[model samples]
Each structure stands twice: as structure tokens, then as C-alpha cells.
Target: MDMNAYLSMFIDESNDHLQSLNENLLRLESEPEELSIVQTIFRSAHTLKGMSATMGYEDLAALTHEMENVLDLVRNSKLKMDSFIFDTLFKGLDALETMVQDIVGGGTGKADVTAIVTSLQLILKSDYSAGKAAQPPLEAAVTTVDGSTSASGGMLLDEFQSSILLQSIEAGLHVYHVHVTIRNNCLLKAVRAYMVFEVLERNGEVIKSVPSVQDIEQEKFDFTFSVFTISGLTQEELQGQLLNISEIEAIVVTALDSETLAVLSNAPAAAAAEAVEATVESSAVKPKAEIAREAAPRKGQAAPAPANVSRTIRVDIERLDMLMNLFSELLIDRVRLEQLSSEIKRSDLTETVEHMTRVSSDLQSIVLKLRMVPVDSVFNRFPRMIRDLAKSLDKKIELVITGADTELDRTVIDEIGDPLVHLLRNSVDHGIETVEERIAAGKPETGTIYLRAYHSGNHVFIEVEEDGRGIHHERVLKTAIKNGVVTEEQAKQLSPDEINMLIFAAGFSTADKISDISGRGVGLDVVKSKITSLGGNVTIDSAFGRGTKFSVQLPLTLSIISAMLIKLGSEKYAIPLSSIVETGILRKEQIINVHGNRMIEFRNGIIPLISLSKVLDSPDFNENDEDETEIVVVRKGEKWAAVMVDEFIGQSEIVLKSLGKYLTNIETISGATILGDGYVALIVDPNSLIK
Candidate 1:
């Protein structure tokens, strides 16, 4: 069968299961006696093994299989679980994840898991005696069922009895028979047949085959076969089903004698009831295990019963982009309709328009929500990362995550993970001190790093904080001066916040010694650039002896944004509402020039001013002496800047469209949007404008 279709699902599910295993394994290390955790690990491993096997990735399958054996022993309480074991298991899971990722990336999914496999084997070997002892009784019970004396008599019933057996089978009742055939090459046929009879179950359950189902699977039965089935299918169908199986040449069906009938009837009832109860118990005992095993590969394990089945369909980003663009057009039309409704003032028509407005608004919301995803999707891998970092640094650190469930646009989520990883590594390698240093500094033995996210207004904020040595402002300033990122005079006039922002200066690192984690060269400048590329801002706050925090604020969605539309010259431009502090009209005389730069006195403070036309490289025009310029004040960090515009066009939400890949180096214009008049207006990038 072509397995490509299942590969995507297998990879997705395998990653999810592996992530769960990683997290739960950490918890298990702390609470080793938690059987539920062990069972969960077992289930994930088992599922991964089955998926790998089905995908024909034998290396992955073999690794997960070995991991499953170890987890099974842990679940059954035969092996002691501890931190060492948990760490080893986590490592194995990580390897398994890597292998799956390899397959997802179109590789062979092969990796050297020899070390992990050996470690697990050693764990099993350490408790081999106990495991062997416990397994023997179950093995013996199964063996007796395949080797017994009375199985031959049950198998030898004649054609007339076989016909009656077929009649009973067609009535939807279970038939039980024992089939015993000596192995084709066996020297003692009689003894082998008797051995098979010894284990014949007296239960009314169809032995189905004289040698038993287990024997059939093992291919232990020879030329002849016996079976009792209560299937509603005709004897010909039953015979054909058996005949279709490989390596089986001859077959016979038999009926029960009077005593055997009594035994069969009573035995099947009790056994059937017991089987039902056991199944329920097994399901309850290890629900995850059962799901994992059923989800594993077998010829006929029954298709998963569909109940409230939700499915995920992979959509191309381009499709969503196109959908967003089309919705933007509809939004513009809706705005036009509202304007037309107001102008005409027809009551009935206005009412219909109002209803359409509400419906369109709801549709817009649904489309936007479809693009919203939890921040946790990006945050999930960080804990494992922090764990590894702390261990390598010889530091005791606790990572605290809050508001991981906070939602953001898919575009932002996709771009945020790498910057967050860089920030976290910075915290571990530079922000947090070693365990001994922390203790000596009157701090707790373990350093604490906090990752928090929350939504406020139309923006979402994510913060990474470390309770370690805070950034030194003077050190940052000195570094900025040395790197020519800031003039000495500029450094002197900088506030503490401004000085701290200097860390984002390219090639700036305060670390005295270079190391793999952070100090070698690249700094927070890259982080800021990445966040700004997604229409977000990054800020740093620190207190000298306490700690440091890096906060990133991003718009809820990138495609469509609430913007303050303003006209500059003959062209309308959009300033994202999230970045606007306030807008007001300013007289030309109120604008002052301080040190050759235009400044406006607003809210009792002098704010720097920039001309929108000049920033956008538009044609210069003579100032209208009698007209008051519209001053839109924007804030980045704690500093305020104002841009003079031709007129205030009012605020409205608009969809942002990219200028396409070919239009490179378009400074200050982040994107373009369609207006109600069906004209494209540029959306300004305030960061680029101010810089």
C-alpha cells in the first residue's frame, strides 16, 4: 500500500505524543511511584512504535519498541523508576522525536540509538530475574491451552456432526472445538496430538482451530486443522476464510457431544461474561495503553469508532492570505454600503443594510479567529531547552511559564519562536549566575526565569524575565560608545532605559568572556529586528542588583489591523493604531526648531517631529500658512515623536497587503491596504520612519 498519505498524520501525532512523554517524564522523575505517568509513557511509546512500523521506518520502530519494553516494566512495577531512569528515558524520547522530524523532512528516519538502546537494555538486565519469574506463569497458562490430550477427541467429530456444527454456526452462536495435528515433521504424532488436547478449553467459545488461535499465528499446526465458530456466515464461508490463510492445506469442522455440549454452553456463558468484564477492566486500567495498542498496527484491530471526530486540514499559507485579501475587499464594500445607506436614509433599506453589516462583522471575526493560535504552541519546547541549558551551565534554575494559552495570530506565532529561544538562552547563559554565586549573593540556591504572556487591548505581550544579575547601564553605555553605536554625548544624555536599549545595538554584548551561548557577537539587535519585522516591539527593563526583563508586544493579527488613517500630501497612509499615542491639530507657529530639528510642545513635553511627506520621499509642498497641520504623535519605548500630515482621515480597521517579493528595499512602508474608494494606500512602518 502507498503509505505517503498516512505519513503526515503519523508525524504530527508522533510529535504530540513525544512532547507529552517529555513533559510527563520530567514529572515522573519527581513522583516516580505515579503509575499513571508510567502508563502514559508506555502508551506514547507503544503508539510511536506502531506508527513507525506502519510507516515502514524500521529503525524508528525498533527504537520505540525497546523504549516501550522499558516503560512497560516501569508501569508493571517490576523496575524501579528514578531520576537516572527518567533522564535516560527523556533522552531516548528526544532521539525518537529527532528521527520523526527527519522523516517529516523527507529523510530516511534512521539514527544511531545504540547508546540509548544499551542504556534501556541495561535497565532491563538489572531486573531480569524478577521479570522472568513473573512472566513464566502467564506463559505456562498459554502453553497448556495449546498442549492437551482431549483436543484430539474434540477434533475427530465426523461429517454429520460437522454439518450440525455448521448449522449452529449459521445461527450466530459460538462453537468450541479443539484441533490437534502433529507437526508435519514430528516423530511422535499421537503424543503431539494429545499435548494439544491437554490445553483444549471446555468453554463454549469456538476454539476456532483445534490447535488454537495462538498456534495458528505461530504456524505450529500441520496439514489438518480443527475449528468451532459461532459465526452467522455459512460453513462454506467459514471454510473459505480458513482456506485463504497461508500454509494451511486441510480443514475439518466438528459438533459437540452431549457432555461436551453441556460443558460448552455453561463454560461459554461464564467465560463470555468474564471476557466482557475483563475487557472493561483492562480498558479502565490502561485506557492510554489500549488506545496506543489499538492505534498500533495489526491486520484487523477494528477501525476507530467515529464519535465527535474533529479533523485538521492542512491549508496553504497562500490560500489564507488570499482569503484575507478577499475579506478586506468585502470589508471595504461594507464600509461603502454603510456610507451609502446613511446618504440615502431609506428606513427599510437602512435596516437591511444594518443586518448585512452585523452578519459581515461576524464573518470577519470568524476569519480572524481561524488565524489565532495559542502561544503555547511556540512555548512548549522551551522547558526542555531550559532543562538542558541549566544542566550544562551547572546552574540550578526553575523555569516558570504563565499565560501560555494566550492567543496570537498565526503569522506572529511562527516568527516568535526563534527570538524567544534566543532570549531564553541569553537568560540562562548570561542573566542567571551559577548555583554557588547565587547562594553567595543572598539569593535562593535556584535561579528563577519567568516566561509570561497576556493580551491587552488589541496587542499581545510576551515577557521573559530572569531573577539574576540585572544589566549594568554604565556597561551598556560604554559598550555602545566603544562600538560606535552611540556618540559619547548621546550616551551622556540617555536615560537608564535608553542606556539599557543600547544592548540591542549591533555587536553589543556585556559578557566579559565570549562563550557558545551568547557573547561571541550577535546581540539583542537581531532579536529587535525579528520582532519589528512582525510589527512588534521589544523593550528591556532592568534593576542593577535585581534582574532583567525583556518584553515583546505584538499586534493581535498582521493581515488586517486597526489603523489611524491620515493623508500626507495627495496620498493617504495608515499608522497602526497600536503605535499611536494620540492625534491632534497643531498650528505651524506652535512647531519649534530646537538644534535644527523640528520639535512640538505637547502635553507639557517637547516631542521630536518628522514630516510624513519627507519620510515617505514624496514631493515637497509649500506649507499652508493658514491651515493647521494634523500632528499624529507616536511613541516607541518612552520617547515620543510626531509626524505632520495633510489631514486626519479618521480611524478604521484595514487589511494589510504585502508589496510582493519583488519590491525590495521599500523603507517606511510596511504594506499597502485597499480603501473604501478602492484605492491602495501604504501602511507606514513607524519603527523604520523614526529610525
Candidate 2:
């Protein structure tokens, strides 16, 4: 099979399965008695393992197989799940995700999973039910072993080995029977056993094996295989050396003598049968579809009929982008047809144009919706992240998410993840207080971080709020002054909100020390810049002892937007309607001068008035010299400003076209759009104007 043809599909399905595993595992931790959750997680892991094997990612398949084993034991009531098991499984999931990401980035999905595999194996071998100690390191004893006993207590020996052991015992040397147990799911059993033999040979001379060393070397044995050796080292010394190797589960080094070997060599048949039975039990791995099916109903209850599965088809993003572009061109032509129909005034042309307009409007809605992805796609990964961060930071946190079904443009969704990550980390590390502090403040020990997303009008709003120690205004001002971001005098004049906003200053951090999660002086500023570059705005609201909330407002789609077109003398400009609060006519006398800056009183508050004609250096228009001016009140986040323009050209849908590379750095102009008259009009970014 040509795996390359299915590579894209494999990556997508792998990510979905991994996400399912993460979510269900987190659920299982909270509800450990829920076997159904375990079944779901087991199914996801099983499917992922099968897919990885088919794709030739053996390391991925191997790690998932080990994880599946532990899950199997838990699901089948053979073993109980605990914190250690959950953490081990989560780590395996993390490693699987990392390897899949490596494959996504055009690399072979291989990783060193020896440590994880060994941990999982140890979980299986541990005894949690009786509260007894789990399996210990290598040991030696005179008693016969439970599973198998060959010669000299437990090491199967032949005539040559018995002679060697007897001579060594007579010569006052140490002849020991060593039984090594390998992990059940070890991928390279023969190699690990070989390494054990090499260690034994370096320390001593090997005498014999139960399965005829050839079978062991060829990987023919199950979990346990016995060996007899003569070494001068003590049992402790030899046991310690073998324990250093990776996958061996247990080791028993029984000191041998002439009497013990003679008595043990006589009864090999019964012991060999026992060893064979034990091997069969340990090495058996069966398909776990039964678990998934079994969880469908209680033991005595009837099974319910299956529900209908939602139908969906995976479409490549590039194909969607192409479809959107073609629709955008069609939209431009539609607007041209409407304009020409209005000008020519033919009855048939007018009727046909109106009909085309209605049809295209419906098509536009469908196309835009096709690009709207649920925010849950971005929010689903946060719970596991918060869980890990809470563990790492030693603080208890509960993440409350709402409106995950809110949708945004696929382009916006891709860029929004990093900023949200930064904000969430900030809340986890700095915004949330420690357990002791929270207790002293009469708050719950577990801090809460709320992530919410919703749609308002034509914009989507995302908020990251925390119920912990809020922003300290005095401390923030002092740091801002000491860091040269503001003078002491300037800080004293600033409001609490403005002071709170200073945390977004470049290279600004209030941590006393740097740590991996944060406090390196590089988070909020990046958040601000990234959100701003995406044509969005972020605002902060905090009460010193209460909490802090960061609200980000973003346009629904970046490619096409309904903009309020205006004329700046001979040039036409379009302002995004999402940013416009209202439009009205204002007299020149209403403008007030505040410390040599133009300000205006509107909506019971005073805001800055910016003359677009003067700002854009218009050749034939000046709104300032006129007795009355047409002003468009626009908002950044909470800040507001009025933009003076020569004329309002009504609202229309416009396709946003990038300026390529050279003109991308322009401050006020966001992009250019083709008007119905075939003239290019630059889109104004109200965020730049307001600040």
C-alpha cells in the first residue's frame, strides 16, 4: 500500500484520537469509577496504535501498545487505576502527540520510549489491591520460585551446567541460578535478554539455560527465562548490575551449592510445564473490542440500539480557501452589476440584478459558514494543559470554559491559539494566588480561570478571567516607573485601569524571578501585539483584591467584511463596521482642546477627535476648517475616538486584499479593497486611530 496517499488522513485522524484520549483521561481522573470512560480511552488508544502500525511508525505503535496494556488490566478488573497509572498514561499520550507532531512537520515519528514503557510495565506488576509493596528490585533466596524452578533452586540446569556448578561450589566459588523476567510488552525481548547475558558474562561465566540459550537469544521465550552462572561476585553485586538494564521486570539470583543443584536437577519436567503455562498467561494480548461493547449496558440490563452517527466529510483547507477567493471575486462583480443596474435604470436589468443579489447573498452566507470553525477546536486542549500546569506550579486550578461552540474564521482560529495560551499561562502563574494566600484571603483553595467565547453583532469576544489575586496597582506603577516605561510623576496621574494596561508594555514583567512558565518579561506584550495584528483588541479590567479579566474582541472573518465606506476628498476609504459605534454630524464648536490635543464630548464622555483629512494629508478636503463635521465614533477596546471625514458613502461588503510585502508596515491603512466603480479604496484600521 502507498502510505503517502493516506498520510494527510492519518495525521488528521491521529490528532482527533489523541484529543479524545486526552479529554477522556482527564474525565477518568475526576471520575475514576467510570469504567465507560476507560473503555472510550482504550478504544482511542487501540485505534491510534493500529493506525500507527499501518503507517510504519513502530515506535508510536509500541508506546501506545504499552499504554493499552495498562488500560486493559484496569478495564478488565485485573488491576486498579490510581494517580500513578493516570500520570503514566497521560505521559504516554503526550509522547504520542509529540511523535505525531513530528510526522506533521515532515520527520520520522520515532522517539525513545524506554522509560515510559518501563513505567507502564511497572504499573502492571505493582500490587495495589492488598496495599502491599509492589515488586522490588532483584533478590536472591533459597526457597523455590513460584513460576519455575530449574536447577539450584530456580535456574534450569543441564548435565554440563550441573557439573560446572558442582565444581564451582566445591572450589569455593559462587554458582548462582538467575531467573530474569522481562516486561510483557517489550518490543525487543531478545535484545534485552542478550544485554542481560552480556552483563552476566562480563561479571562471570554462564553455565546453562532452561530453554537452551538459543531459544532465549532468538526471542522464543515469554516473560521469564532462567539462566545458571558461576561468578565470584556476591548475589547482591550481580543483582545490582542486572537491575541497571532497562526492561527487565524482576530478577532472582539464588546462591547455588552442590546439594541444592543435585536435588533441583531431578525434577525439571513439572517445573518446565509450570514455566510454559506461566509464559502463556503473561504473553497473551487480546483485542479489547469487548470492553467497548461491554460498557454499553449493565451486566443484567438489555443493550440499547445504536444511535445515528453525524455525517461529515473532511475537506482540505486549501480547497476551501480557493472557494472563498472565487466567491470574493463573484461578490465584487455582483456589486458592479448592482451599480450598473442603478445607473442604466432598465426594468429587466434591475429585476435581474436584484435576483442575483439575493442569490449571491445566500451563497455568501454559506461560504462564510463553511470557513467558520468552532472555538472548541482551540479550547478542547486547554483542560489537559491546565491540569499539567496546576501540577507543575503546585497550585490548584479549575478551568471553566463556556461558549466553546462559538465560531470564528479558520484563519483567525489558527492565529488565536498562541495569544490565548499566553493569557492562560499568565492567569495560571501570576493571576492565581498560592494555596496559603488564597486561604488567608478567605477564598477557596482551588483558583478558577474562566475562558469564555461568544459572538456579539459581527465580532467574536474571548475573555480569560481569573478569581485570584487581582492586579496590584501600586506595585505595577512602581515597576513601570523603575523600568523606565513611565515616570513617577506620570504614574501618579494615571488611573487604575491605565496602570493595569501597562502590564502589556514590551519587556514588562513583575515577577521577582524568572521561571519556565512565565516571569521572563515576555508574555503580555506579545499577546497585545499578536491580537492587534489580527485586527483585534484586548482590554483589561481588574479590582485589586478581587480578580482580573482580559477581554479580546475580534472580527468574525478577516477576508471579507461589511465596511462603512467614506470619501476623504478625491480618495475613498473603508472603515470596518465592527469598529464603528455610531456616526453623526458635530459642530466645530463641540470640539474641546485638552492640553493641546483635540477632544470632543459625546455619549456623556469626552473622546479624542481625529481629522481623517489632515491625518491622511488629503489634497482637496479639510474637515477642520468646516463649520460642521461628519464624525464616525470608533472604538479600540474600551477606548473611543471620533474620526472626521468629508462624506459617508454608506456600507458595503468588501474583500480585504493584502499589500504584499513592501506596504505591509503602513500604520493606519489595513488593506485595499476594490470598490464597485473599479477604484481601489484603502481600509482604515480604527484600532490604530483610537490609540
Candidate 3:
């Protein structure tokens, strides 16, 4: 059989399982007594093992199998959890992730995990330490029932699985317990089982399976198996789907009530392990569809089925990008149509154009949402990273994350990982003090680092702050002066924030010497450059001996957005509505000069005034000497700017188009947009213009 067809799916699922293991293992480390956590880790590993084996990655499968054995022992109370065992399992997980990554990079998922395998073996063989012999206090009863687990392949649901079923029931979904028996003399039992799964999977998500998926694939079961599934299909419909897969078998589907599910969920370990054995007496055969109707509710009535199985599916990001591009072209034409309709003042044309505008607005929202993903996907990896780094540095630090559920563009999420990693590693290496130093400083033994993300208007802000030995101002200034990043006179004139930002300059380092981790004058500069290239800005704030914060302001890029189109001395430009506070007329006399910079006062705050024409070097800017100048007030975080323009063109939806590589590095202009008259207008990046 061809395995190539399944390779991509295998890789995606393997990565998912690996991430699950990492997350659950970290939880287990914190709560070793929580066997429930161990159960989750075990199930993820078990699933990965089956997938890897099916993909012919014996090394990955074998490693997972051994790790599963250890987890089984720990979860069952036959062995105890310890730092040693946790470290070994972590090693196994690391190896598994590496192998999966290799597969993603177009290599066989093979690795020399012999050392990991040996460590797992040793852990399994070693006797439980005397002090750690007993199971967790709450799990004592569960551990006692472990040895009496039934051999019959039964659908045993844990708390996690039970909650899913209960939630499905609440949502008006059907939870079915299906018992399927194969023929006594049936050949290729595995293939038949696969067919049955394919049917059920098409109808619903199988929450739990008897004989375990791996055992069924290995044909370790006698004949019959059971499954617990959640679906929007009625018993008749679901049974029909399953019965289409041919095999000599008897099947029964029981719709479970919440009461019965609760009883089974709280059942003792023994009853929960109830099994289904394959045996043949004698019975007349019937049509598959007939057997299906027999699965109808015994109560003579049924609740409504769910709408359908989930309407969601994984879509490649490239597909979304293509969709956005196509929508951009459609949007341009839509604007053109609206403009023509307005010109002609015809009812039919205007009405049709109005309808198109409404429909396209809804479509535009959906297309933009498709590219937004939760930052949690990126934040989830940091705990494990911090654990390893803290252990290596022999320091005690805790990572506190907030607003992880905040969403950002997938493009930003993909590129932001490495820069965040650099910032985090720097915090651990340079920002946080040693244990002894922390103790002597009248602070807790462990330091705290806050990694947070939040949305404000059109931008998402990410702040990495550490409460430890802050950036040394005198030292950084000396380093900046020595490195030629700033003159000695320039250093004297810099503000505290400006001096803090000096760390992001190319080839600037304050470290007395180079270290393996950070302080090589490399990471921060790269971070600044990468973020800037993404139409974002990074700023640092610090105080002596207190803490430091690096705040990154990022854009929410999409094809279509509402903008205030303006004329810049005969040339048109666009300003995103999200960034604009208000537009008004500012007389030339209202502007003030402060240190050779034009400034204006609005809402009791003084902010800089920037001339759009002067910034863009427009030839027509100086030709007119109007007494009053039109200005748009825009803000980036707390900093505000009044951008001068020639005229306001009112608000309209514009399609954002990127400036290709040849026009890259045009700092003030972030992107281009198409106007109703079919002319291209540069979108001014107000965040870049301010300071």
C-alpha cells in the first residue's frame, strides 16, 4: 500500500501530539500526584506511537512505546514520579519532536534515541524509592484497582473524554456507545476495522475506542470492539454509515443519557474497564440498514440531532493568502462600480452596487479572520523553554504569561517566535539576578518575568518585562560610546528611554565578555531589524536596578481596510481609520517650535507635527502657502502625531496591496491601496512618522 498519501497528515498530527506531550509533561512535573495528567500524556503518546508506526517510523514508534510503558507504570502507581524519571521522559519527548521535525523537513523520522530508550528501560527496572512508594493520596483507591483491569476491550472514558460527551449532550448531540463484532472466520480483520473507523469518522469524532486504536491495528483483539462517539447524526444515520462497510457482524448502538454517562464516568476502575469479547452463537442475518433502525431510541422519542459534524477544517495558509489576493481585486472593482453608480445617479445600478457593498463587507470580515490566530500557539512553547534555560543557568525564575489568547496575524506569529526567544533568553541570562544576589537584594529567591500580549486599536502590543537587575545605564552608555553607536556628546543628550533603546543598535553589547547564550551584540539587533521589516516598532524602557521592558507594536495586515484618503499636494495618500483619532483644520499660527521640531497641542497634550509633503519630498508641497493646514491626529501607543495633508477625501474601504521587493524599505509608506477612481495611493504608517 502507498504510504505517501498519509505522510503529510502523519507529520501534522505528530507535531500536535508532541506539543501535547510537552504541555502535559510540564503540568505533571508541577503536580506529580495528578495521575489524570499522566493519563492525558499517555494517551497522546499512545496515539503518536500508532501514527508513527503506520508511517514506517519505527524509531519514533519504539521510543514512544517505551515512554508509554513508563507512563503506564507511573499512572498505575507501579512506579513513582521523580525528577530523574521526568528528565528521561523529557529527553524522549525532545527526541520525538526532533524526529517529527526531520520528517517535516523531508527526511525519514529516524534518530539515535538509544540513550533515551536505555534511560526509559532503566527507569522501568528500578525499584520505587522507599519514600515515594505509595501513590498520591487521592489516587490510592484507583491504584488498588489498577491490577484488576479487564482484558476485554471496553470503551473506558476518563474525565476529559466524559466532559466532551457531556458537553455534546448539552449541545443536543448524540453520544452513542457502539458494539461491533466481526465474523468468527473473518480474514484481514485490521482492514475491516479500518473500514468501520472510516465510516464512523465521516459521521462523527470517535472520542474513545475499545481495544485501543493501536491494538486493533495490530490485530490483538479477538473479534469485537466498542467505541464511544459524539455526532450530530441520529442512530439510524450513523449506523447506516457504519453498516456500509462490509463484514459479517452484529452491531448495537445505544444512545447514552447524561445520567448513565455520569454513572459510567464515576464507575470504579474495574467496572470502567468492562470489555466486549467476540463469540458466535447462531443467529439469522439481516440487512445492514435494518440493523441500523434497531438502534433507535428505546424511549420512543429523540432529541434533535446537532446541525452537522464540525463545519471547520484545517486550511493551508497559502490558500487563505490566495483568497485574500483575489478578494483584493474584487474589492477594487467593487469600488469602481460604486463610483460609476454615484456618477450616473441611476436607481437600478445604485441599488445593485449597494447590495454588493453589503455582501462584500461580510465576506471581507471572514477573509481577515481566517488569517488571525491566537498567540497562545507561540506562547505555549515558552514554559518548556524557560524550564530548560533556568536549569542550565542554575537560576530560579518563573515565567508569568498574560493575554496569551490575544490573536495576531499568522504571518506575524510565524516570524515573531525567534525574536521572542531571543528576548526571553536575554532576560534569563542578563536581566535576572543569581539566587544569592536575589536573596541579598531583599527580594524573593525566584525572579518573575512577564510576557504579555494585548490589542489596542489597529495594533497588537507585546511586552517582555523582567523584575530583576535592570539595565545598567552607566555601563550601557559607556558601551554605546566605545562602539561608536553614539558620540560621547550624543550619549549625554539621550533620554533614559533612548539610552535603553541603544541596546538594539547593530553591534552594541554591554556585557563585560561574550557568553554562549546572549550578550554577543547579535540577538537584539536582529530582533529590531526583523520586527521593523514586519511594519512594526520595538522600544525599550528601563530604570536602574528595577526592571526593563521591551514593547513591540505590530500591524494587523489584511487586503481590505477602511481608510481616510487624503490629498498630499496633488498626490493622494491613505491613512488607516483605525490609526486616526480625528481630522481637523490646524492654522499655521497654532503650531509651535520646540527644539527645532514642529509641535502642536491637542486635548491638553503636546505632540509632534509632521508634514506629509516634506516627509515624502513632494514637489507641489512648497508651491502653495495656505494659511490653514488640514491635519489628521494619529497615535501609536501613548505617542501622538498630527500629520499635515492638503485635503480630506472622506472615509472609504480600500484594498491594501504590497509594494514588491524593488520598492521595499520605504519607511514612511507601509503599503499601497486602490481608490474609487482606480488610482494607487500610498498608505502612510503613522507609527513610523511620529518619533
lDDT for each residue of candidate 2 in 1-691, tens digit (9 for 90 to 100): 4789999999999999999999999999999988778767876786677667667888998898888878766665557778888888889999999999999999999988888999998886667533335534433422223333333334344454466568779999988877777888888776677677767765767656656544554466676777778786798667656766787776667776666677656555455445434543554222223323434577889865433234788888899999999999999998899899999999999999999989988988888888999999999999999999889989999999999999999989999999999999888888899999999999999999999998653568899999988888888888899999999889889988798899999989888986799862368899988887776778899997788999997767557788999998889999988889999999977889999999999879999999888777889997757899788998865789999998999999898898766785677777899999999999887876765
lDDT of 1 by residue, 537-630 (tens): 8888989778999989786755667789887668788888877888888887897999998888988899888887766766744345446777
Q: Return whichever of 1 and 3 wins on TM-score.
A: 3
TM of each candidate vs. truth: 0.65, 0.64, 0.77
Ordering by TM-score: 3, 1, 2
Worst 10 residues of 1 by lDDT: 137-146
Alpha-carbon local distance difference test for all models: 0.69, 0.80, 0.80
Which runs in model 2 stand beyond 4 Å of their true positions?
Answer: 129-315, 563-651, 658-672, 679-691
Q: Output the number of the TM-score-best candidate.
A: 3
Off by over 4 Å in 3: 129-180, 184-218, 225-248, 251-290, 293-310, 456-458, 480-498, 505-508, 583-631, 638-646, 659-666, 689-691
